[model samples]
Structure formats: C-alpha cells, structure tokens
Target chain A: MNHKTASNLALAAAFAGLLSGTTARLNAQPVSGHEAGVSGAAIAAGVAMTAQDDQKLPKHSCKGKNDCKGQGGGKNAGKNSCKGKGDCATDGSKPKN
Target chain B: MTLLELQRRMEQDVRRPLTAELTMQPRTTEGESMDEIAAAYIRPNSELTSFERLEIYNRQYWFRVIGAVSEDYPALQALLGDERFDALVLAYLKQRPSTSWTLRDLSAHLPQFLEQHAEFASEQHRLAVDIARLEWAYVEAFDGAEIEPLASDELAKLGPESTLALQPHLRLLAVDYPVDEFVLAVKKPEEKAVTSGAAQLRQANVTTTLPAMAPEQRYLAVHRYDDVVYYRTLEESEFRLLKALQERKTIAEAVEIIAGEEQVATIQQTFALSSELGWFCHPTI
Candidate 1:
C-alpha cells in the first residue's frame, strides 16, 4: 500500500479498536432505524453524549463570601448580597449639623 | 463654563490618583496647584476648604474603586500582601481609570497590567499573573454569557467537516502555575467571621499565608454551570483540542493537529470526555 493509504488504514484500525465498545453501546440503544447509516465517528459522539448524560460532570461551587451576588443559592446571596455594606465610602451617614 | 465642561473638570479632579497617605495630590498633572483648581470649581463650606472638599471626593473615589477591585481579586491581594496589593491596584487604576459604568470592568486589564509590571509580583511573578487570570476568569464566568448547549441527539450530526463552537462563558487557560487550587485555597475562608462585617472579615483575612507550591504547568477550563463558576482541570491533549475547536477548526482538522502529538488512546479519551461535558455547539453562522 502507498504511504497515505497505509496511514489512513492504520488510523481507521486504531479508531475501530478504540470505539469498539462505544459502537456497541450506541447499538444497544433503541434504534429508530435512522442510525443504520451512522458513521463510526458519529457513533463515538453519541456514546460520549450518552455516557455524559448517565454521569453528570463534577462541579465546584463558590465558597463563603466568594459566592456571586445575584442568583440566591449561597448562604449570604440574597438580601445580604454583599452590597451597600459600607465596604466602600458613602457609609449611609449624613453630615453632622 | 458650560455644565459639560464643568462636570468634565470635576470628574478629572475626582479620578486623579492619591498620595502615599491615601490623600489627594497637591498638584494636577499639568503642574497646576490642586487647591487653585478646586477653588475655581468648588465652593468652600464652613468645615472645609474647596481643596479639602475636592480631596474628600478624590479619596472617596479611590476608596470605592480600590474596594471594587479588591472584592474581585481577593486572591491577588492574598498573594501580594495588603500594602503592595493596594499600591499595585492604585498604580493600575492611575493608568487604566474606570470608564465602564459597572465596577466589574475595573480589573479587566489587571492580568495584562501584571504581565507588563512583573516587579509588582516579584519572584512570584508568573504565579501572580496566572492567579490574576484565573481570578478574572471567575469574575467573567460569574455573569458573562450563556447559550443553549448542543443537545445529545445532535451528536449524531458531528462529522469531519463539523465546526463546533464552545459556550461563550467557557474560558480556557494554560498557565505555568496551578493557580486553580491556589485561588480556591485563598478563598476558602471563615465565613462565620464575616458575621462581624466585610471590613472586619477583610482585616481578619489579611496576611493569610497559604502553603507554598512548586511551579507546575496546568490547563484549566473556567466555565459556569447553573450560575456557579467552576475550575475544571483539563488534560493537555484535551486543552489543545478544545483550543483548536475554539478557533473554528473542523473536527477532522483538530484531530489531525493533535493526533500524532499524543498517543491515540489519550486522544480517544480526551475526545470522549470533552464530548460528554457538552462543551460543543453548532457554530453560529
């Protein structure tokens, strides 16, 4: 085989080996008959999405005062929202008479 | 003078940088005496002179802007002690004054500022820059923007010619320091102490020396999920792939760029994980 065709075949073989179970997983899904002509890359993408759907990505939430102002899930998110706290000037005071 | 001219001059006075003691400078940039300038615009009251009244506005201007910047980058403050941090912020503000109505934009230029002024960060310069970038990413992810993610079934449509776009809020950063953990460490705080007040909390959190870390390369994805910003570590291959995709490269082109750079197994895993995270969307035409 020529260099280009040989490399392409090797790449396809590698992908076939890597996506073996992935294609199986995709196949196990209820086929709506539309998946018949799906390419291996498409099958791999589908498997990845299905796996992600099954297992949610781990997330890290802001801690303590680091939580953002709006969107009230944090301990000090709402009402206290960390604004107008005299943290800045304009301490909400009137000048003495 | 016209109201617009008067207002412009007043704003110029208010936005000028303060002295070492946090007081207004004695003279303007044009070498004019500040007291003389203030007299022309402001009326002296019983308690204070025109210059002193203008100083109040000037100092308060510094206070509000510095406080806003401090709020956004407490990690940077913790990295460089309070005094140096304040000076750095002061110097930065002097050059890039707040032009946006929102305080959020105050520190937008901070990362670039640190890159140019490595002296501010000293030996920890690179780490400081990385932390600044990561912290700014957090600020952006806080409320930057969000678009509907690509649906699962749409994965079937991905092909060699497909050009996938990442979420607008997703930020990719490659740094020479593991600033992701460092920022988290700096921010993990005594919230109970804040019960006293923000100022008191600020006082208590000052001089908090975190454990030192060795320099290490890190790839990060700063993204928002459900309104909470997060830092997700990415493998080198994954980072490169996402970066290529971000540049509007086709999936086949992206794979070709990274295929031989790493083992095929690594590429396969990276592809799977990135796909699972729903980081892709149809390219907006």
Candidate 2:
C-alpha cells in the first residue's frame, strides 16, 4: 500500500482493535426527530442578522424588535410573544379615568 | 405568592426574558413589570448608570452569546438569512432556555434541534447542525476532560464479546451539509475552497435554474483526539460502522459487518482511518 493507503489501514486496524460496549452505552442517546427543534434556515438567519449589524448596514425586519419593526415582524413581536399578557392583551378590559 | 409560586415566578422571570424573541429586551421606561423584575435580578456592572443602561446590559448579555452562536454557525445563518435565524434562535431560547452561567452551554442541543426542524432538509441545514455539533464537541474536549491516550494492548485483554467505551467528551454526529466546508469557511472566511464532493454537488444548482438535492442533507463524525477537536465526513457504510460500534458491537463484529458489503480493501482502509481518530472505546472501573 502507498503511504495514504498504509495510514488508512493503520487507522482501520486501530479502530478494529479499539473497545466498544462502553462507548456504545455512552453514545446511546437518540437524536430527536422533530421539525421545530432543528431548522437550518433559523440558524442561518441569526448569523445574517449579526453580520449585517456588524457592518452597521441598513436592513429590514422580521420576527425581531430592534430596527426590524417593519421589515421583519411577521408573527414575532420583539421580546414578548403575541399570546397572553402582551401585545395581544389589549382586547377585553376597559379603564375609565 | 406561595413559596412554590415564588420559586416558579422567579424562575419564570429569569428564564422568560432570556428567551424573548426580540432583538432588544423589554425594559421599564417609567414603570413596567419587566423593568421591576430587571431591577430585582440585574445589577449593572458597566459604566452606564441609568436604569435604562443597566437594562441594556441585561439584554446585551443574551444577544452577545447568541451572536457568538451565530458566529459559530454561519452556514446556518446563510441558510436562514438574518431575520429568520434570529427568530429561530429566539424560539430555541424560549423552549430550551439557558440555565447555565456560561454562553457555551447555548449550543448543547443544536444538532438535536436541527434534527427536529421541518424545513431543515437542505444542505445548509445539515451543515449547520453538523458544525454546531463539532463546535460543541471541541469545547467539551478542551474543557471537560483529561485522559490517557489509547494503549495498543488495551483491547487484547477484552473477551471476544466484551464492549468497549468511548471517552466522555467525544461526540459523533450525522449531518446534512458538508459541515466541514462550512466550518472551514468560518476559519479562513476567504482563503479556502469548498472541496467536499457533497458540497460541490449541492452547489451545482446555483448556476442553473434547477434546484439542488433531493434532500440536501449530509452526515458527519465529530470527536476529540489527544485533546484536539476533529471533524470528519462519514459514508453510509462508515456511519453504520460507527453506529454498530456505538451499539456495543465488538471490533471483530463491526469489522465483519463493514466488510460484508464493502471490499476487503475498503473495509481495511476505513478501519485504519477510524482507528487514528481514536474511535475505539476504553472501558474502565
């Protein structure tokens, strides 16, 4: 075998020789298969927002509170969700002075 | 509030603001509930004295760490764009809110989180998950443990059916994008070429109108070797091999399985490659 091939073989032998049961137990945790938990798009957007800020460039908003009020706020409304005790809480009660 | 209620409320107060999806934290301009909570928990450590400035510090703390995570997973940022990524991170903050005092704990479930994303079938998504996994592993490898190197004779003493154990800080991941390429981009930003066959194939659609990838995901292996964090690509066979080993299969069994479909030469090659990575487990008392 050539150098790369020899090295590859050595690595394989080493793998073959390495211990396993305890390792298996340690790695037994399963990856959850849920959609909301992992989204590449969500992760990417975070980076873009930061990079844009680092450049101090003009930007649009979506799902955020800062300058993104118009461009970004689709369903998100800054620090508080639109559900209870927040922006949505303005409906029922009346207070007269 | 009852003690239980007070505890619950305090915990909620600490956690809710930390996970809020907004760019800036909610504050008390004059007299707001959040501001009151902030006044209670936060003590300003910066030069700014105004309560407003103090609140700003509280908000900045979370954003800073999140931004660091964004730095750690730029490919993810690229895939989600600026707005959505922040939103997703905010969502992540809400559900699996941080409990640690350090920012590094922020990435603990990133790979698993990405695994659960509905739209994360894209190569970028896969790359993001994988790089996140590697980055976290690297952190753990550096901070979590100190151990002896593999001794060649260690496995010889084991019975044919005995199971070996992997190191505590090591992690193996399967991802969608060529995460190595994504991390490489982060490391050099400008100099490196994207070389993985998977990455090239996924990118091929950019020049044309065609959409790339039926599923656009990739697989990965992340681990620690002699205190250095290392990431490597895994073929289907290789991943299964690792999986089997992870499932407590003996080395001979794992080799037999890997060698079943693959050529003896390739299996031998793979075994050698995995060995150097210290993919073997070491059992202890």
Candidate 3:
C-alpha cells in the first residue's frame, strides 16, 4: 500500500481504538437516576460502524460522468492547480512567487 | 450617474452570476434588464458588446471568489467534486454575502451553513462538516491575531487560583473524523515530473476517492508557531481542562471540572507540554 493509504488505515485504527477506549471508560462509570441508561460502548460502536462505512467509499472513476469534467477527469486534476497563487497552498503559508 | 452610484452598479453587476452561463442572462435588482443596465453603465469595447464587457467582470469576480474558496477548502472540493462544490459556494455566497474586506473571511460560516443545509453535504455529510471545521480552524490559526504567549517562567508563576487565557490564535476543535491526516494526505507533494502527454493522462485517471476515515472523536488544538499553523492532538481530559481554562476558569477549578485524581498525573503532563508549546497567554491572577 502507498504511504497515503497506509496512513489513512493507521488513523482509522487509532480512531477506532480511541472510541472503544472512551466508550469502555464511560460505560464503567456509575449512572445517576436522572441520566438515561445509555451504553457508551454502544454509541462508540455505532461511530466505529460509521467509520467502517467510510472505508467502503467506492473508487470513484471519471469515466462517463459529466460533472467530472475539469475536475478529477482532466490532466491537471490533482496537480497543484494553485501554481503562483500565494494563498492557495495547503500548508497555510504564503507561497513564494 | 455619480461615481458612487456607478461603483454600486458595477459591484452589483459583478456579483450577479454564480457561473459563466448566467453571464448571458444576468439577474439584476428591481427587475432591471441586465442588458439595459450594462448599456447604461459599461462602454462597449471594439471586440465586445456592453453586456459582454460587463460579463467579463461578472465571470472574473465569481471565478476569483470560487477559486479562493476552493483553495482554502481543497479537501471539501475533492469530496464534493467540482460541480457540487461550485453549487455550495454559490449558495453560501448568496446566503452569507461577503461582509469582510478580506476574501479569507468568506468561508467563516461554511461549517454552520453546511450543518443547516444537509443537501449540499451529499452522503459524506459528517465528513464534509468535519473537513470544513478543520479548514476554517487552519485559516484562523494562519491569520488570527497573535497575542504574546506566556513564557515558561510566567506560566510557572501562575498559582492554582490563577486563570490562564489561551493565545488568541489558538483554536480548539472537537471533530469526529481524523481530518488532520486527510488534509495532510490531500496536501501531499504533487508529482511535478508528469510532463509527457501519456503520463499526464495516466495521472488524470487516478481516482480522487479519499479513503474512508474512521469516526473517532478528536480534541484538536490548532495553533500557530513562527507564523505557521500546526495541529496538535489532545487527550479528552486535557481538552476539557483547556476548554474550561479558555472559558476563564481558574486552574484549580478547570482541573476539578475535568481531571480526576487518577488523571492528575496526565493533566500535569499535559499542562507542562501546553506551557512548553506556548498554548497560553499571560494569566489573570
């Protein structure tokens, strides 16, 4: 896998772990009478399920799609379309002309 | 017509069309014919009609605004694709017209706007909102006012009763998606060597489908150091404590609010790290 894909997977795993841990901790805590008997683990699991759904985003192709024109379809798609435009750089720093 | 009146007319004309197609039949206030307004205000050049001349400004204005917004929120653009993003920008511009002198402030309400209008979010509604929030936070950290950060010694002098204020440039975000990583991935260095036609075609075919980020609640601190914006991930307790402190709670009070006896060591570590990172301004004793 490429670095980007690997990093994304790592982040997803980390987030899953975080949610699981937080949910378990919250679940272990005593619930007051006024508080609803909501399971934090269940909530976290639901969120984890959503994250898993995200991982299932089908590989988008520009073929036969009208809206993809000049977007992910063209030769300049993911390239630095912001060349010479100082404020457009992703690093939040002004690009040197 | 007076210069101010002319200026107003031009401004109105410039912001008329959300897209180039609308330039041909641009809308005007009070049901005034666009052609008539253009004819009255704009002088036709050798190569263009009065309306065409005015259309140039109209198209340019939209292009510049859209371009700036697209640059600021590239991940959002990628997620929504060009068409939906265009629609969102046009709608957002109409709802929240540019009131600030700087174009940087144009996207300030985008997150809230996305929240209210779920149609624009597509299926990735939550992802879009998180990305928008992250992008806006980055923008704020980049250009927000910079207050003098408290020195280590100054932070050390603060008693438990002292209320510490965070630096003006600091922004706290509670996000569900790991958007920071996604942003970094999107901003990864583009291959500059794809000059040949065949290679360029291959590059174009590469899918823009971003990997699905797992939904995890994250406490993020976006801050600037040496004029460059950076993201710092914070623990939940640390986030809560900092948030309380930001709300003007005294250190003791903030600690009590979020940190338990078991979390005291972790909170102390976070406090030291925050101080070292210059996350605070001068404390109000």
Candidate 4:
C-alpha cells in the first residue's frame, strides 16, 4: 500500500482497538456513580481521566461578601461563583464568600 | 421489474416527506398513492399489509435521524425546550434532509437554519445562535478527524518562514455569549438533576434563578485530545493569530497580522501553551 493508505489502515486499527477496549471496560463495570445517583465522585473521576493535562483551567469561587455577583454579572452568578479565573486562590477549591 | 427494483422503490417511498396523517396510512406518491406503490412492489405477510410494513421503516428512519440530532444538541434542546426543539429539528430535516450516509451530518445546517428563520430570531436570537454554534462545535470536536500531533521538538524547529498547521479536529469559534459553560453545565449529571422536575418547578417559582448570563464577546477553541473533547477559552489576539496561521500564513506573517508588540508576546505565550496542549500538527517547511 502507499503511505497514505497505510496511514489510513493504522488509524482505523487504532480506532477499532479503542472502541473494543471501551466496550469491554463498560461491560465489566456496573452503572455505578452518577447514573446510580451516587455522589459526583464518579463523574469527577471520568472527567479527570478524559480531560487533557495543562488544559485544566482554574475554577473560580466567590470571595468575601460578594456572593460571586461581581464575577460574571449574571442572575445565576453565585451558582457558578466557582467558575472563572484568579478569583479562587487555588484551583478546584471553593472560595470563601 | 426485478426484486432489486422493487426493494429500491419501496425504500424511496418510505423515505418520503412525513405527513401529519397516521403512520400506516397510505399517502400520494408522484401520481400514485402509497398503497398503490406498495401493492405494485411490496409483498405483505398475513399479519400486516404492505403499507403497514413500509410505515415501520418510515417511522424508524425519521426517529433515528431525530435521535442523532437530539443527541448532538442536548443543550440546544434544553434551551428551546422539548416541543420547540422537536419542531425545529423536524422543520430543519424537512428543508435539508440527511444527504450523507452518516447521521452526524443531520445538524450541519442547523446553525444556518436558526440564523435565517425569524421565529428563532426573537430577543433570545443571539443566545439561540450561540448555543447552536457551541453544540455543533462540540459535536465536531467529539469525533472529528485525528492527526498525529506535533511533538515539542517538531514545533521548536519552526522559524518565521515555517507554516504551522493546526490539528484537523480543532475548531475555533467567536461567540457573543459564554455558551461553553452552559453546554458543560447542561451535560453534567448533577446539573441535570438540579434543573429537572420538582427542583426546576421550585426554582421557577422563586425569583432566584440559575446564574444569569450577560452577553460578552468570547473566543473559544474546541478540540479533542486523548479521546475526549475540551473547550479552551482564547484571547481575541490569540484567536486572530491562530486564524491567520490556519489560513496558511507563515509565522512571521501571522505575528505581523496581530497589532502591537504586547499582542505578539501574548501570541508567543498562547503558541507555547497550545503546543503543550497538542493543538498543532507537523509544520509545513
């Protein structure tokens, strides 16, 4: 095969392998965690696994008495007070409001 | 005609435009009724008529198309609600139809459709458009074509004359609203539970609502890495620089396209960050 055809075949093989692996993993595990209405831990784990490193943007939190109102200036501002940058001192931690 | 001809005719008849009448009811086809078409081609079993058998395939086709679009645009559905979203999908399909073999192309015209239609062009028109764009970006990022990303060594060899190529799966979007967050919120299981059923009713009753979204200009890069899709917010300058690069501009030309030395610095930082994030592919020398 030509180089392009060989590359295409390799990609197809890799994709097939990924799908089979994912299917096997799903079959072996129970639908626990989020689907079972457990905690958000399962979802968090899944996100961590899939999300790229260095692209984990920091989460913002409400500071002092602001209640996150000054953050995004939305009606549901406080809801995601933990969203945005530089507001939270640490990544993934809730800010003191 | 041969059996192949008959099968083809039956498939064509079933794939016709869905009418408001009953599913199994025969409708007109060209000059002939559906029953006449079916009678001429399809062989019916003892339990059901030829038209009834054909209707089953008809409903399945429509449902599958609708389901694929819905799966791809859950956030859009949540924003427009079930009834309106269903109407929008049906209307969209009626106009465009799925010409591609894959169901993924079903919503390719949706953003443009929403743009042209005045019904969705109300006060929430911008929001609707932003949601559609974001959803489509996510869909494209999810299963878009993949390429072997450029390594740090490969990226470092690039000079002003070198042309940098972005990964095929990367999609750059300039949206008026922060629809990326909204898309993520709607997709999360916890957020779904909070916004659904009794909680939704109670929240609706109370003046306190889900976080409000004030319109703001936003630039986003939606891409897939490690088999998962991600939305990375970008600065306006960075977005412009990347756009220029993607358009086949050389590194020096891309830098010249951006205004001021500060912007050039920002572009450098963004380039470094993007490189680390595997946003680029082999550079064209």
Query: Who wins the TM-score comparison?
Result: 1
The regions of model 1 sitting more than 4 angstroms off are A1-97, B190-209, B260-265
lDDT of 2 by residue, B114-155 (tens): 767735435455545555666565556445553443545664
Candidate 1 per-residue lDDT, tens place, B1-285, comes to: 899999999899988887786677999778999989999988887656788777766766666677677777878898998878977898898889898866778889999999999889899899999999988887776667676655545655555677878877778999998777778766653332323565444323333347676899999887765444666778787788779989999766776665662346656665554444445566892
Better of 1 and 3 by lDDT: 1
Regarding lDDT, does 1 or 4 come out ahead?
A: 1
TM-score of 2: 0.54
Please give the ranking of all candidate structures by TM-score, highest first, separated by commas: 1, 3, 4, 2
Model 2 CA lDDT for position B156: 53
lDDT of 4 by residue, B133-244 (tens): 8888877776677776564355446565777787777789999998876776566423222356755553322121233567999998887655566667888987987888
TM-score of 1: 0.71
CAPRI class assigned to model 1: incorrect
Residue A96 C-alpha lDDT in model 2: 36
The pairs that clash in candidate 4 are: A60-A82, A64-A97, A75-B212, A76-B211, A76-B212
TM-score of chain A of each: 0.23, 0.20, 0.31, 0.31
Reference-based TM-score of each model: 0.71, 0.54, 0.69, 0.67
Q: Model 3 over residues A15-89: C-alpha lDDT tens digits?
A: 333333433443445467656454442232111111222233321232223222232211122323333443232
- Categorize the docking of model 4: incorrect
- Please write out the lDDT profile of model 4 over residues A3-31, one tens digit for every residue: 44543443333233323333333343446
i-RMSD per candidate, Å: 10.5, 13.9, 17.2, 22.1
lDDT of 3 by residue, B127-204 (tens): 899998888887777667766656435544656577878777788889999887776556442333345676554332
Q: What is the lDDT of candidate 4?
A: 0.61
Off by over 4 Å in 2: A1-97, B1-54, B119-146, B192-219
